[model samples]
Target: MKRTIDFILAAAGLLVLALPVCIIYVLVRWKLGSPAFFRQTRPGLHGKPFELVKFRSMTDEVHKLDSERITPFGQFLRSTSLDEIPQLWNVLKGDMSLIGPRPLLMSYLPLYTPEQMRRHNVRPGISGWAQVNGRCAVSWEEKFRLDIWYVDNQSFWLDVKIFFLTIKKVLIRQNVVGVDVNGIPFTGTSAESSSGK
Candidate 1:
């Protein structure tokens, strides 16, 4: 049932945003040169890997940090979440759901404690409980807690709630952090940050 909804909505989204997606693609290409899509392997359901795609919001400056590489247009994309429009394809591809725990880097797999690891029990999402709650504004530990909470409490109604909240957050542009500025790398389990509960 959830998969059905994800597929239907994702398909509709791609169709509805087709023109805008193309415009963003062309703009990204003009502004950032080739490879307008940013693709990365993210852990999906049950820790499986899938390529997550978004618009290229940063310059191809290998020597510079992500924070330094982000362009003004990229910041606009991030603030408006236009960069994520391409990820509807991921949902259509069965790599993601409409609502679930947002996928994290595969490198962070080993860093998660047993409790925190439970987030991968379901498919990753473009928007999740943590995203609407605090996004990058909250601590990584707290984000994990929210993720786990969603993992445990997820339902049709919950997804419905999150879907709307996500719209509101994106419109208001709340809690978004600059690239690599506030999203601290998770090292491993610690007394202060390990518990996902």
Candidate 2:
């Protein structure tokens, strides 16, 4: 039933937003260059791997990290969340849900504790409990806790709430920049961090 809602809403969203998406695509290409989309392997349902796509917001400057390569237009996309519009296609393709835990990198798979692994019990999403609550502004531990909570308590109304909250967050551009501007990667499990690994 949830998947049905995801599919229907995603399809409708794509249709309604098509023109805006195209404009963003052209703007990203014009401002950022080729590869208008950014693609990365992300863990999906039950730890399955899928290529998650978003608008390319950073330049292909190998010498500089992602934060440094991010242009003003890129920041605009991030602030407006135009980059995430492409993921509606991922949702339509059955690789994601409109409301669930946001997928993380594949490398983080091994780092998850048994409890944390429960997040993968359902499909990943473009926005989730963690996103509405604090997004990148929250600590990894808190985010994982929220993810697990949503896994345990997921319901239709809950999803509806999250959907609206995501809109509010995007409109206000709150907590859009979760990590540091240096593009520091997410550190691993707390234990690993404690061990300096």
Candidate 3:
């Protein structure tokens, strides 16, 4: 039932935004040059590996870490939530949902303790409870708690709430971080920094 709604909404969104997506692609290719798509291996349901597609919202360079890799245009895409538009494909492929725990890097798999690993119990999402709450401004632990909480209590209405909250947050540009040319800045970096890089 949730998948049905996700399919309908994601397909509709992709169709409606096709032209804008193409314009972004052309701009990215013209500015960043080639490989207009950024592909990464992210864990899906049950920790399965899948290629997550996103617009190339960063500079094209080898060994450029994320913190130092974001571009001005990429920052715009991210802040406006336009960069994520490509993930509708992931939704269509069933690699993710319209709402669920947001997928993270495959390398972070080992970083999770047994409890934290519970986040992968369901399909990943384009937006979720954590996103509508505080986004990057929230603590890592809080984010995990929200993710786990969503796992414990997700439903059609909850997903609907999250979807609407996401739209409001995006339109108001609330609680999201600006990208630095070199990286995606961590909002609670001092806390994270005390632990380590």
Candidate 4:
């Protein structure tokens, strides 16, 4: 039932948002040149690695230096949460789900403590309990705690709430800070004892 819902929502979302994304793609091509999609390896369920997809929200060059070097339009896409739209493909491919802990880079997998690694018990998501709650504004510890909590309490209804919360978060344009490159190094297994477990 969950996979069914994931497929249906992911497919329907991709279909409906295709036209806007086309416009964004053309703009990105004109501005940043080819490869409007950015693909990166991330840990999926049970810490399995997969190519996570997103609309390119950074110049290929910017990626080489830092994501903060992102173009103005790229920043807009990220702040608006549109960069995440392409992950529906990952969903359709069964590499991700519509709702789960957001995937993190493969580099972070080794850093996970036994409890932190619990986040991988389910597929990664485009949006999760942490996203609507605080996103990048929250501390790394808070974020992981939320992720672990989702692992224990996830349900169809919880996913639905997260979906609706995501829409509201996007509309209000709140807590949509960029990925914290220099802010907080992901603490992983060393995360100051996640009390939320």
lDDT of all predictions, in order shown? 0.86, 0.84, 0.80, 0.80
Q: What would the per-residue lDDT of candidate 1 be over residues 30-136, giving only the tens digit for each residue?
A: 99988999999999999999999999899989999888999999989998989988889999999999888888889989888888999999999988898888777
lDDT of 1: 0.86
Query: lDDT tens digits, residues 27-116, model 2?
Result: 988998999999989889999999999998899998996669999999888888888889999999999999899888787788778888
lDDT of 4 by residue, 1-197 (tens): 99999999889988998899899889878887788888888889898889987888666664466555688887788778888888889999999998888887777777777777888999988888888778766777677789899999999899999988988888987644334423556756443354444
Candidate 3 has its poorest 10 consecutive residues by lDDT at 177-186
Report RMSD for candidate 4. Answer: 2.6
Judge candidate 2 against the unseen true structure and give its global Cα lDDT, from 0 to 1. 0.84
Error of 2 at 34 (Å): 0.7
User: Which candidate tops lDDT?
Assistant: 1
Most accurate candidate by TM-score: 1
Off by over 4 Å in 1: 175-181, 192-197
What is the Cα-based lDDT of residue 38 in candidate 2? 93
- What candidate 4 gets wrong by more than 4 Å, as runs, is 62-68, 175-183, 189-197
Residue 85 lDDT, candidate 1, scale 0-100? 86
